[model samples]
Target: MGGMNKIDEPTIERARRGDHRAFAAIYHAFAALVFSVALRISRVWHDAEEITQEVFVNLFRKFSQFGFQSSLKTWLYRIAVNTAINARRSHLREDARRLVYEKTAILREAGPDPAARLQAEEEANALLDLLPQEQRVCIVLRTIEGLSYQEIAEVLEININTVRSRLKRGRETLLAWKQGEPK
Candidate 1:
């Protein structure tokens, strides 16, 4: 909602009317945000890319059903978060050895610097991965994406207090984990 003025009612109307250019414009505008959220949640770049594509597909398919009670950003956030959560659940059931192998391959492709920025990003993603998915979603939405509690609540379809609760718990968990880490 911050700078996503590209998804206004007129654009949505054009998309709903089967304007491919309008849909492509919406995808171009929001794809990065959606992909970042998915990658944060999933910790897999390819999976995040797929999730972004799926989100746009679902958005197009469900466009007619949108009631417009919330901002388009809110609706898109809902779809992205839900899709990422589902993908994470399925991913967890996959072979752990394969996941490790893929991660190693990714790290190798990241270059030889042990203290590289990619390592820092990996560490940050690992910390987020330590969070339960429910709390992690709230934390990412609030801290990383800069959504307000009310906006998160609306996007998550939960009470504002629920959003606050999740944020508090998520922060506490990250603090505890950080404290336990070696300096």
Candidate 2:
């Protein structure tokens, strides 16, 4: 949200009016943030990349619908979160279908010499995956994205107390997981 504040009303107006430069400027400013959020939620690099592209396409198409009521960052966060969640759900469904047809398909492990950091990150993401989707989203926004509880509430359109509760539960679950306790 730091660099995001630099995008002013005039820039937004220009983008809304279909100015390509303005739109590109906005994309440049926010694409990384959006992609990181998507990646955290989707847990697949390719899916996250696609989600980022889809988000920008949707923003361009729906730019005119954005009222000035909410900050643009909040609006973008809402879009990114919803889009990522939907993509993750669709991916899970597709995987289930594929599994039914490819029962004999062999699974590949990570490369023989994967980086330690990468392995740790994969383990962390796997743990996050164990949480319910709602709780996972709350934890991602709060911890990884450094969003405030109120900001998370605004982005997810939930009560602030619900945000707090979800984060609390999510943390407890992750702690239990790390401690080798049954979920």
Off by over 4 Å in 1: 97-116, 181-183
TM-score of candidate 2 to 2 decimals: 0.86
The per-residue C-alpha lDDT of model 1 at residue 112 equals 67
How many residue pairs clash in model 1?
Answer: 0
Give the count of colliding residue pairs in each prediction.
0, 0
Top TM-score prediction, candidate number = 1
TM-score for all predictions?
0.86, 0.86
Model 1 pairs whose backbones collide: none
Q: Write the per-residue lDDT of candidate 2 for residues 1-183, one digit (tens) a residue.
A: 455447878999999999999999999988988987898888777788899999999999999999877888889989999999999899888784322111111123345444554566667677787799999999888888888888899999999999999988888988998899957
> Residue-wise lDDT of candidate 1 within 41-75, one digit each (tens)?
88777788889999999999988878789878889
